[model samples]
Target: MRLKFQFGSFITFIGFILSSLIVTLDLEAQTHQFKLIDEETNRPIPDANFFYGNEQGISSESGDITINFQPTITLTISHLQYGKRSFTAEELDQALKKHQLALQPKSHNLQPVTFISIHPNAGEQEQMTLQVQDKLAHDAGQVLEQFSSISSIRKSGAYGFDPVLRGFKYDQINLVIDGSQCATAACPNRMDPASSQVPLNMIVEAEVMKGPYSLRYGNAFGGTINFKSADPSFTDKANLNGRMGTSFETNGEISRSEALLGITSKHADIKLFGSLSTGNDYTDGDGVKIPANFYRSNIGGKIGLKLNSTQTMSLQVSNNYGKDVDFPALPMDLRKDDTWLINLGHKAVFYRGALSSWSTTMYATKVDHLMDNADKELNPRMVDANTSAKTNNAGGRTELRFDFDDDWLYAGTDMRIENADGTRKRNMLMGPMAGKTLTDNVWQDARIRKNGLFAEYHSQGDNFHLVFSGRLELNHAEAQNPDAGFAANYTDMSSDIVSPALSIGGTRTVTDNFSIGLWLGSAQRSGSLAERYINYFPIGLDPYEMIGNPELKPETNNQADLIFNYKSDATDLNLNLFSSFLNNHISSEIRKDLSPKMATAPGVRQFVNVDKAKIMGFEASWKQIINRKIQQVAELAYTHGQNTTSDEALPEIPPMEFRYRLIGSFINKKLRTELNFRHAFEQNRIAKSYGETKTPAFNVLDIKASYLIVQNLNVAASLQNIFDEAYYEHLSRSVRNAESRPIYSPGRSFYFSLSYRF
Candidate 1:
């Protein structure tokens, strides 16, 4: 076997030499000066990859690259957002002389952030730039709602939309901000999820990992959402910069304003930013007003010090506050929410020896939440209930990466501590208990601590790449209140979970334009605080109460994926097929039995462990340049899931969806217009035991246009749902009444935006 491996390596080296010689002979003395820019904006496209023969390098900040190669040699230029493009040496020379070498950007809606392993297959990583995100999502609240694979569950109209990815949501998915875990929601009903805390404008980029194939992030059973916030940029000398902008929307009379300021020096840098937004009740397509009023404000800053050329330390702090929020799906409204976050980090780099780099990070978060039914229209016999809660999260992580010949290893340790304490007070009005006040601890000082050690190994070969990772974690949780009405069913509330994570995948390049890849992985996720210890909490959007089971076991998933990619000068295609089998799956079961203390509850359910379950899905995307002035793109996604243990379909699974976009650029590519058509098939498969309902099919059309008025001034206009169709997503919540009709989406509205950079 060793001899055969050696022979294969020798043959590969020979083929490489022969290919280089053939290219060298084609052009004995040829030099190409290349300049890459955005086709639409004509701005420099930085950090783009360029390759010719065996020589490769990344484009500079100015998007300029000068290369000496054969006249017939092919040059490849690839980027995460722009897709991949190639040009011949002669074509490059002509473009350079004519000043027309620019990479055409793919429609942002169709791009997919994927994981692949080899040559032409692992060429690109998809992500949305800050500029694109800013244009699409006007407010921070709309950020996650724009993701293609994500569907928002709106307990409130537009305030807190929890993102569900591939039929998994909330604690089932891992949400990380700058490689660190944030605090969980303070509200028992999860009025505010983790993604709500990070303001949209503050994010520089967001990358979504579709499945558990990659485990660098912690306990990603369904997937991972990684958000990167804007940081201070380095400067040669002292410099100062800042920006301010404002916008208004017609549907809800929404108003928003934001500003950022930064000062940078050779050794130190500082940044400060803030935003404020307010909106009134939004009307539906039928002109019926929904009680969705909200107000939000946040302020944050960061300071960095350069200890040396290769070492740095930084400190960051942020605070967020919300007031007078209304939720139509629940019985209560949010009165106030105050949250604070702090992080301190250090990073260092080494140029020589086996050690490549190391980084350390520590972060803390605290949330104070208050809610009540004082502002809502309630029954005369109902009680006026008020709830207040506080949650704290703190953690630290340190990782070291080692590099050797053709191989790399990462070793790290991470720890997280979380605690929840809250209480609810009710006042009776006309009953025998009128004028009386009743108080109870909602969570009773519940505390959970998790510690983990992990390591990952990777290797590179001529035609195949390999990745493997493992992790061990310990979890302990307890609550102060042992009363029967509370979480008193604790027979040993501690579990030393030895969770193992592994992924093995590689790509085989069949040709320059085609590749095939396969990946297999196993991931495990322990139960969350709400799933394991909460006595009574409302599941967001769903009409059910959640009861905890302290003895519930962790969930494990073994998954497999296959990938196919095709890239050419005018076309890009990607398709993925994936499947997962889960063991000890945690799901909620409706309960009819009620104790004396719970007899008055509206809806009742308990968390339980299932023996087995399975899910399978596929995603496909295609992009083509129909002409020099037109582009066409299409994407399709669907997921099928089942609970074999209960012989039923999984609840809350999204239906089959597809999107088609037609983009046109004219006037020397300065002006752009887009017409998009979106469609969703009716969801007929649902778990009847969970009271899941079937939805009807719907189609919607949207039109948008943007133009650059001047060098620093830009304007954009959009007409959403041009026909004013009244429709609702499958995951939308129902009204908190006897009728329980699902909430409808917004009506047709005209939106316009303008901004100027100074």
Candidate 2:
């Protein structure tokens, strides 16, 4: 991969933005001492800036501020960790005279832990912040299902539930680890999304942006998922700490073991983490066994150097291995998989001059995937077939931040290069092709290069806050296939495309407990390698093969969002409405005129660019305290999508769904319990041209509880599918082993976990 850089042009652009920072000051000064802290954690907010008119000062390491302010001045405070807030000078003076001021924490939206369980004795407490160890103990090794807005598209009854957001899937969503882009799935069927590469025990925090609001992340059309790893905790003197945990589930006979160790010092810290998980075929409702089994192991470590209090540098590396991974819904099962990832980063904060902070990071990842059909039963004794795919990705970003009196600017540039290639081989065992082997390159030598420059601006005033952002993007892709013959001419192609994205949004506070906000954005997505180069690739759960169209145009999306939020001591509510109009949407179309080779083949579809499409939806979530001892949380989501040009519903779209939880706490907050209910409406809309299938509605209930046996040790138990109902999700794949029946979710099962830290 090659990239062209214009440093001179970028320097001139930065100079122009800097020119706006040199204005004259207007102030009536009176010295005052103040402190800023987070309302939720009561922790000091370092480097928070306080502004009065044109006078500005930043907080010290301990969040202490000594600033001169006018009696009539309106104090505006801002921080990257926290959004923005404004207060009257008199209010601040009163709080300062009394002590520290606690700023109501802004919406973290950083994929914080959302509790879904109910402890019989616990009341009204729906969510609890969990450490790495606690999360591992609570979750059944399912990493991506932690977010409320995200749901998984299960391939089987076992591991690897591909995450789906809103109505978008696959490349539409971007997944980043430690601020670096990750490699795409080596399997055309996407058995291995980026999230599956890291075990839950390795994640320190997960952040999700719902839409294309932040331009810093690459091509964030659907959204961006940032997985932050645990950094070494530092102390005055060097210290060694460690933790170990294990869990088991009765339904699938699943078990997981994890361990973590760390060494921390004032200036340096290092840590290592590892996990091993295994599960057997699970039984669905009616006691029918489901052929879903998998085994996975992962190990990772990070080393950090403080480099003083204002600057830091870190390096991280990880590897994951999988074996006996079976996908009953897909054409092939994973025989083995190996993945490796490495990243290095440097950051500097509290710097002098207009550059309040600057950071740079670099990362690379590689994946080797192999799958075959040796375990499946074939009607006619047939040959053996296997696929070997590999993908590599490397990218880095450098960003600069500037803070002013009432506004801030964030600008950065990032680039990601990806290379993928694979081969499929079929050996004839009993047919005419028996004793002979035929091999074809599925991906060829395909490559994709994406380079982008982005900037975001945020400003605060009396009663409203505004955020504006934009990105300039350029993309290129090419593939080489020699043995494809006519297919080569059809799939061998090159593309160089350029596009721009813009978004502007604002929030107006109706009152202290309620707010209304709106945003409109335009984003573009270039065709992926598999969308442009793959030949006869089975991307779905069925035997349908997909052909790439190299001459495809980039898809464009124009969307609008409206949000209403209300928060109080006893209740919290959020409602969101969104609509998107897409241009040149790419989807599979059955084409019968495929040269002579596949003209009569059933389910052979080719990717085609459609003229128009629309996706609109709404999501509502409510949490209310029924009493001091019990709480309730409910969420509802619905999405409708169609090919406006064809007047048909889109294929593989999820159905309307709702989830509710009843929670309770007891034993002085040491024991908690939750009762959960989930419902999905039947999906009748089908894309007949694309061989779509309809699914029936489902309802399920679950119960869970957790308790602290003693300090540093915890125990949890859960009963899922309490009624043992037979139900399948709308997005579940048609199972091959079950005569094309949709794979049903796991049946009644009991799970228990325990952890102790030392």
Model 1: per-residue Cα lDDT over 1-758, one tens digit each: 63353234334433432332211112224444455767654555654556667555555433555466567888787654465679887887787675346787642211124321100100011110113325224233356545657777777876877788878888888887767757688888777778777655456556687677656657768887877654434556888865565666678777777776788897888978787778888777778777778898888988988665545678888888888988888878889989898987766544345665576777889999999989877655458888899888877677776765456677887777777788778887766788988776667666667667778776644444456767677776666554366444457654556667776775665665676777777888878878766666665336566777777888988888788888776898888888989999998776677442222355767788999999889888898999998989898989888999988998888899999999887776557788989999999998777666898888899998766566545566778889877788888777776777777777787767655443
Candidate 1 colliding pairs, count: 0
* Regions more than 4 Å wrong, model 1: 1-141, 540-542, 596-600
Those runs of model 2 whose alpha carbons end farther than 4 Å from true positions after fitting are: 1-38, 41-134, 137-143, 146-148, 481-483, 486-492, 595-603
Q: Tens-digit lDDT track for model 2 on 73-146?
A: 88888763366778897897787674578876553221111322211111122123123223453222255554
lDDT of 1: 0.69
Candidate 2: RMSD to truth = 6.3
Q: What is the TM-score of each candidate against the true structure?
A: 0.83, 0.86
Q: Model 1: how far is 468 from its true place, Å? A: 1.9
Q: Model 2 has how many clashing residue pairs?
A: 16
Alpha-carbon shift of residue 389 in model 2 (angstroms)? 1.1
The number of clashing residue pairs in each candidate reads 0, 16
